[model samples]
Target: MSKGENTRKRIIAKSAELFNQKGYASSSLSDITELTGIKKGGIYRHFASKDEIAVEAYKYAGSIVSGKIHEALDRETTATGKLLVFLKVYENVVEAPPFIGGCPLLNLATESDDGDPVLRENARRGLDNTLELMKRIITEGVRSGEFKADLDVDALATFALSIMEGGIMLSKLDGDNRHVRSNIDSLTAYLKTVAAAS
Candidate 1:
């Protein structure tokens, strides 16, 4: 990579880490520069402002976590399997650092709080897209006889998103995985009750 490209990437990477660790509101350009070892001028060459880095960094983080979910959902051969896989994916995500602060969408949504239009819109889109994905899976499950014919896919999907986000928030605040597991278990049980036999 060119020197300029490398420096830009370094800034984005460092910003992502700090944002995930301290949140968007708390992280500053100085924190990013200190962690990246890049000069303010060099960073300016890449990003115009902290808001720019935040928008890009938050997008990067969202893509990372979403990629994992996409992978899990893609690997499952059945709708029921995919549904279960979604729960498992969150359970696994709770294991380590990047995910320790919980879902970036939730963080950005709450922290931005109608502040940064870009970040808030991105978070809104991410959340909406995630719910849509879940709804699609549930819709397919019903068509394939894996979910109840009369099931309310949209309602269930909204609930799934709520529980997962709430669970992650609680897990992060409490610094424990139990809430995450509990949420997954509750989701699983709820799905089973609504599932249709193949």
Candidate 2:
């Protein structure tokens, strides 16, 4: 890649960590500059504004998370297996978070909900993307006869997302991975009951 392109990506990657570690409102340009070792003018050269950087950085982090989920999905053949594996990804959040801070989706949503207009929308979109993925998995499970056909896909996905996110938040706050791991186990057990038998 060209020098300019590399710089842009570095800015995004570094800023993503900064924003996720601190927050959109809490992170400053100087903090970004210190983290990236790039001058303020250099950063401005690549991003028109800090908001632009935040939006792009968020997209960058989101892409990494989405890629991780897709890469690990091939191990499961059944729809329910795929969903469980997907949820298990969160089990590692406490030990090995996708980002420096934690789950970017959760962090961004909690902090940016009423902050920056553009950032708030970006966080909302990130949330929607996750929910849509869960919904898609549940829908496929129902169609494949792995999940009960009569189950409410929307509600199920929402419940699973809520449980996982809540567990993650609690674990992060308490400095314990047990909370998330237990939630994953509980979710797996619950889904198994709803899954169809051989």
Candidate 3:
């Protein structure tokens, strides 16, 4: 990559980490500059304002989750296997420090709603993207004969997304992963029943 491209990436990466760790409202431009070792003027060269950086960072985090989910789905051939893998991946995410910050969309939604339009829009898009991905996976499962023909892919996708985000929020609130893990276990079991009925 060119020097400019690398610098932009560095700023985004650092901003993502800071936002995840301290939240968008709490993280300051100085914090980003200090962490990235890039001057404030340099940051402005890449992003017009802190809100812009926050929006980009939010997208960056959501893309990370999408990539991980896609990878898990790609690991198995059958729809049932893919669903199982996806649930298991969430279980594993509970054990990872990175996810300890919780879902970026959930975080941003809680903080940005009624406050910042850009941040709210970013969170909304992240959630919409997640729901779309789940819908696609459920559709695949149906085509593969791993899901019942009567299944409501849209509802299931929304429910799955809600459960995952809800579980993460509960985990963060309770300061324990047990609740999240249990919810995930239940989700997996539920997915198995749906797959078996196909």
TM-scores, one per candidate: 0.92, 0.95, 0.88
Error of 3 at 153 (Å): 1.5
Q: List the residue pairs that clash in candidate 3.
A: none
For all the candidates, what are their Cα RMSDs to the real structure?
1.8, 1.3, 2.1
Q: Which tens-of-lDDT digit does each residue in 65-127 have in candidate 3?
A: 667777777877876566545445556444573443657778899999899988888888877
Candidate 3 local lDDT, residue 10: 88
lDDT, candidate 2, 96-152, per-residue tens:
886678888888889877766788898888888888988988999999888887999
Candidate 2 Cα deviation (angstroms), residue 51: 0.9
Q: Which of the numbered candidates is closest to the native, going by highest TM-score?
A: 2
Residue 127 lDDT (model 2)? 82
The lDDT for every candidate, in the order shown, is: 0.79, 0.85, 0.78
**TM-score computed on alpha carbons, candidate 2:** 0.95
Task: Order the candidate numbers by lDDT, best to worst.
Answer: 2, 1, 3
What does the lDDT come to for candidate 3? 0.78
